[model samples]
Target: MSGGSKLWGGRFQKPTHELVDQLNASLPFDRRLARHDILGSLAHVTMLARQGIVPLEDARAIAQGLRVILQEIQEERFVFRLADEDIHLSVERRLRELIGPAAGRLHTARSRNDQVALDFRLWMREAILEVGEGIVETSQALLDLANEHRDVVLPGYTHLQRAQPLLLAHHLHAYVAMLARDLARLQELYRRVNRSPLGSGALAGVPYPIDRAFVAELLAMDGILENSIDAVSARDFALEFLADLAIVMAHLSRLAEELVLWSSSEFGFIEFDDAFATGSSIMPQKKNPDVAELLRGKSGRVFGHLMGLLTVVKGLPLAYNKDLQEDKEGVFDALDTVALLLRVLPPMLRTLRIDRGRMHTAAEQGFTLATDVADALVRAGVPFRDAHEAVGRLVAYCIAEGKTFGELAADELVRFHPRLAEIVFPRTVWDAVRAREHPGGTGPEHVARALEASRSELERTARWLQQERQRIDEAFARLLSEEFP
Candidate 1:
């Protein structure tokens, strides 16, 4: 069946072409916004009734009709068809069918243009919250794991070469810092995405005195969007969101890349818990870090989405163009990608079995104490450049002799520079790792403090999320009671 569209059909004498219908239909992807559409419509209709633009009885009917549609959609009993085109039209069509002519008043002071902007904004608000929670979840895991491994020393790397001995906790908390910054980005996005675009009425401001502010309040938005054209046109919010997500995915990819590297036999720093690892069909002994690899690969996909959206919205004169329809699919995919990645990573990390021996063994072999030796030279009144060069020679000599730092005694170390013998030197990787005990250093004490701070931050974030979600929920409850009660 063609499921002929009537919403925009009045001027067209004939039905839309079959190919055009299939090609242009957004219902397949945008039906996910049905709930958000109804929510926006209810707030809009309620405001219309309050403004006396739509009669109170009609407003009630529209609200009731929308709620009924919401229930049907929720129950999957409502039939979605190609003709409905998008959630706005699908919802309006159903509302009209249920309440006769009064439901036609539902679009009283709005256009699908501003309505969808409102819906997208509402969806983005919830998404930011959900993604924030995922970030917290992942950060909490990192914190707990860091706390658990505070005493374990691992080799820190630069250019994929071991550079220094660091506490495992410090290695883990680096990701916590990245996530903290990403959360800040999300906070700003949440603020930006919470502004209401309702009453913008296609491209221009609505007539008949639509209560944009009241609608904003009912929808829990921060305020009305100041420019009606910009309100419906700009998708910088989505760009910012995807940009933030790209960075987020980059962080995750970096971490997942580490997990993949760490679990490899060449590194042997950690072993994945078998449940999270995949086995190769051909190689009986092969245990693959597929989860981490996939997470890393998925980063590119998210980055592409960000760039794709950026490409889509460029050079467009829009107070709502068809190109804007390209927005939701990328967002939906990126949201699912980040959320699912977060869901798997925390547990994958928790189940990981760290090879303390392998880590320490590797930490010792990399001449990881070069910085410590340099610092000792600096303490002996050598300038840092000279000290760095002196340590560089010592490291080269050790490598040439097939000797590690531990094999070099203090008396032999003095061969590099006579000032080195009078100054402190780290005799072992453990000593080198512990020597930098300053605040924020990778020293055990510093890591313990950082882990505590991370735990505290996670707790505060949890409380904030709970409170914010409660306010949003209460807004929904109040809106529901007024219309449905």
Candidate 2:
């Protein structure tokens, strides 16, 4: 269909060029939102009928036609055509074809502006929940690893140099903390996205006596947009959702980068399972962390999507512009990118291998116990500054002699600092680890408490997620019953 031959083509005298039609076609990507667009249309039609704006019989027929379309789309029988600009127009054009003139009434008191806005919000609500589930799954994987490796020690780094000793469990749980914040941000985005904008036709309120709250209820939105201009003009929800996704992907990339580093032969700190790694084409003894590398690389694309949308919406005026049509491609790209990452990361983590012996050995090679030695001296009435300088001298001496801190004798320590006594020397790695008994430290008791707390938080988040899913399902069920009953 040429632009002038399209449904809203009354004012145009000439047909739009074929090049413009191809350029404007969103059916290839936005077609993924077909179900959401149909659902939003059903809710709007029901509200129109209840308010006597459209005949109840027309509403019933439209609802029935949309249900059939949804089923066809799901069954892979529906063919989206490029002549239709987007899912909104494509579904509307099909509904008109299926049910005759009454299908035209479905667009009453609505514009492509508010219609697409509603579709995006509905899609994002579901997308955020799915991403949250991915985060929960990843958290559980880390929790399992932490439980299995609670007693294993690893070197914690600063500027890529080993600076301290910590339990492997403690190190893994740090990711859990980062992900918990990510989950909270996603939930917040859902709350903001749950508001309805259907009554905002184009950039102004529709003249018809439509009940926006009733439509909001039908769509299971928490509230209605109070101002019509603000409703159609605002892409804040999209911006916020994309920004949240970018942040989460960044955290994931950081973790993936570390996994890549740890799996290297130079570090020998980890050994990923064959399922998550790949063999080099030319090297006989190479297992690359290909999954982690991909995840890290994909993060740049997600960030680009976020920035692209921000730039598109930054200078637009207080109304729906054709520029708003540019919103879908970037938002769709970001959603797809994040969803794919979430789906793959959990399984990769679950299958990856941990080299506990290597981690323990690396933990001991550096002067990771220097803090413990300094603390021991502090307890022996030596000032902390003095103890720090004393440990620094001893570390330099050990480096020159090519010996580990643990290999130095008590007399050797005394040679660096005369104030040092026999009790300052730790006999084993476990002795050094157990010495850190402060709360939130990597001591055994502290790690156990943290594990319990993390388990409790996960349980709470799971309950909230289940309830939100049920709420959305029930709202759709009600919409179906009201129209088809």
Candidate 3:
């Protein structure tokens, strides 16, 4: 047995079994955090030098070595080994190669526990912003589609049955609204994820004269994680991220479901572009909406990750356990899945052809105007429940007579209730949709205003993304440059 691969093997007399090494190694997946690990180490060493815990020359050496490792990783030249266990060790091992023993002093005031926590938080901060940007782009795509088809009418459903007429824009806006909440969740969680977890050494505060606030500021984080124990052990930020991603996936899945249904011959409300659709291996006539189906199907994987992390953390005693190693793969995978979903869905929606005539015709065929007719009855001085019942009977009579609401004459309508004759029913799908003029309604004007509001909201979110990204970029650039306090 050999202990050469283990960084913390100083006290152990013999190395663990090879199977244990393979079981415990995280470098395979966690190499994704290599850049973040280097960034965190840079901040830590800079702070250590500034606080006089380590000499400025040694700090410069470590910083220079880390920058080299970062460049190698960025250029695809950095070698990662499973024996190094995880990103922290992989980078440290490489840092040793580049700068010798000065790399050893780099870990002076921090534990791998706090170090890993800080690295994950830093990575998640960038990820939340990236996911937010993806949300913005996706929202923009939906808005563009809405703006283009603001007047196109479709049947809105309740319990998978047509219930009312809605603008296509209004329908697309529903997803934009859902994604807005998803973006808001990421923004809110960003605050929690942005706090620094460095200086909380191994679940306890370090005794050295380290400046946690300086380190946090250097990394452009919001603040330190105040509680040392929580700083190292808390995986709540990851959990929140996964939960938010699951919601985003749910929204995408719903939209994907509609796309699937609409593209089907039974609905024929939309058609996917050839680029977005896949053909059956044996059935040449079939052009499948595989992207949409995938969007719907992959949601479960993200949901499972959220639940998996919840279960992983549910039984753990706080303050950093080996079990916490289970956190990154799920988070990394969920983020990738969500990012891919956001990336593909917008284009899938944008390129697809909508059958406006088909949607309007379908909208007209369903008794979507039943509610409007009921409301008209109430306006004509009928009591609400009586009006509902009267409309119910009218629908039944139409169904029995092989008639539609529009096919019934005034006398025929009056047979249900004399007052119904006094109220003119909405004559067309547009009339049914335009009847809803209130704020947030399906009316054209309301949807137009909603699109404008979404555009403005998108602009605000875009500005925020730019500012936040710039702040982090500048802070990181300064950390690498020759300028030092």
User: How far out, in Å, is residue 229 in model 3?
Assistant: 0.3
Each model's lDDT comes to: 0.86, 0.84, 0.88
lDDT at 446, model 1: 79
Candidate 1: tens digits of C-alpha lDDT, residues 349-447: 899899999998888877888898899888878999999998899999998999977677778788888887678688887898777789878878877
* 1 or 2, greater by lDDT: 1
Q: What is the TM-score of each candidate against the true structure?
A: 0.96, 0.95, 0.97
Q: Clashes per prediction?
A: 0, 0, 0
Give me candidate 1's TM-score against the actual structure. 0.96
Q: Which pairs clash inside model 3?
A: none
Q: Least accurate stretch of 10 residues (summed lDDT) in model 1?
A: 1-10
RMSD of each: 2.4, 2.2, 2.0
Model 3 C-alpha lDDT per residue in residues 1-485, reported as the tens digit of each score: 01234457668777878998998888899898888888888888888888889999998888888888899999999888888888888898898998898889988998888888888988998999989999999999999999998879999998999989999999999999998899889899999899998988987789999888988998999998889998888898999999999999999899999999999999999999999999999999999999999999999999999999999999988767888889989999999999888888788778979899999998988688898889887887788899999989989998899998877888898898988767787878888888888998998998899999989999999999999999999998988786643
lDDT of 1: 0.86
Best by TM-score: 3
Those runs of model 3 whose alpha carbons end farther than 4 Å from true positions after fitting are 1-6
Query: How much is the lDDT of residue 6 in candidate 1?
Result: 43
Q: Better model by lDDT, 1 or 3?
A: 3
